[model samples]
Target: MSLLVCAYVFVPETNTTVAINEQPKAPFNNLFGFESWRQTVWDSPILRKHNCTLLNSLSSQDIYAGDAVLLQLQNELEVIKEHIDQITDELNLHKESFAFRIDNAFEAIRIAQKVTNGIVYIG
Candidate 1:
């Protein structure tokens, strides 16, 4: 089975305390899939530095605020771009595909940051 990593922009209605509603009204986009490449993301040194782990990283159960996590992901994107060669070599990932995935993830986070009370949902 393939486990897809997806990101969404969620804006809670005013007066609502829930982070994620039972049925999310906002639309979401798929960023990447954690299939054969799961290990690459799970073991990323940059992600690790940001406290992302296999179990918690990008999962809906993540306790960190979405904006905070998205900020960390943005930082990771810069580092990944700077050390693309090394990261690809270390993770045995396709450079182009990995770059594309990271870029899409960043874009999703960027959009999420624009809305009031917006948060990212990754699963």
Candidate 2:
């Protein structure tokens, strides 16, 4: 089985007077398949060092408010991309494929960062 890392921007309904029982709306522009790279991301030293909640959580549902988390994840991905070539073959990682996945995931996060008063959902 392959794991796909997808990010979506969810804008909550703004009903100040009374609570509305309606599903949140999100755009499908930000999405990418991570394939088998879930473990790689979960074990990333750069992400671990920064204590990325979204990336580190084992839960299927994770949410982050604002672009700060998005920017931090993007930076960590950049650091991993820089040193991806240094990873040993013993880990069975494809440098090119993994790099492509990182790029796609980066773009997804970048797109999600543009939404104001919206929460980012990762799963």
Candidate 3:
């Protein structure tokens, strides 16, 4: 069997939150956050991808650490929680798979906040 390993690289904050959180300038696309593998997994045709694509976007930079970034992370957790609730209602029969992923993501966010002292950055 092939192994699928997940790796994350943490970087330090080099500038203040303003420098990092500014709503991307004209040259940029103004979008934030990284797409999780959850996206790809749910995209499978057999899975019957529903309208529960809420956790797909994050409103802050993934490679920077700051209060705004942490806030964004927290917000994402809340979003996931809400999505979980909605999805559970819609797909009562198959809530385990989705709920498990949401739970894992929430736990990951909590751990990152604790370990990094609210300064979690992805590289």
Candidate 4:
């Protein structure tokens, strides 16, 4: 990423113990110590312990490294999505066949009903 250098920034710092530790504005900022913050975050053992961590510090730009990885992952996801669609299509086809069978049964019952009604004439 880019360096966020803001000159004349009003960063609040209120040390309850010592006024000497105060920066400029009100409220405490024991959490935002400069060198300690750098060491804790940029120089932590979680990152610094790995040999690959040094490469991250070297790069000033090209912050969106995950884009290429995500693009590849999206392609894979699309393939899986297509497979799921195919499976769903097959399932729906089976359901349609079952529905057609039911329709055939209902048609047979309707034809039998008409036949029975034809013979039961009271006129």
Q: Global lDDT for candidate 4?
A: 0.27
The digit string of per-residue lDDT tens for model 2 on 34-85 reads: 5344456554554565555556552344435346766766766676666666
Q: How many backbone clashes does candidate 3 have?
A: 0
Q: Which stretches of candidate 1 lie over 4 Å from their true place?
A: 1-29, 44-65
TM-score of 3: 0.40
> Quick one: best TM-score, which candidate?
1
**Residue range 21-102, candidate 1, lDDT tens digits:** 2222234344554654444564556556544453235433432236666676566667667777876787777998777666
Error of 1 at 97 (Å): 0.5
Tell me which of candidates 1 and 2 scores higher on TM-score: 1
Give lDDT tens digits, candidate 4, residues 1-123. Answer: 222211111123541111122132222111211232243433344333332242224233211112243233234323333444443354333444333322332232222233211110000
| Tens-place lDDT digits, model 3, residues 1-123 | 111111122445753321123222233222222244333333222233433223232212233433565566556546545665554555442566555544444444444454433343332
Per-residue lDDT for 16 in model 3? 33
User: Cα miss at 120, model 4 (Å)?
Assistant: 18
Q: Rank the candidates by TM-score, best first.
A: 1, 2, 3, 4
Candidate that scores best on lDDT: 1
Taking all chains together, the TM-score of candidate 2 against the true structure is: 0.57
Query: The CA-based lDDT of model 1 is what?
Result: 0.53
The CA lDDT at 112 in model 4 is 25
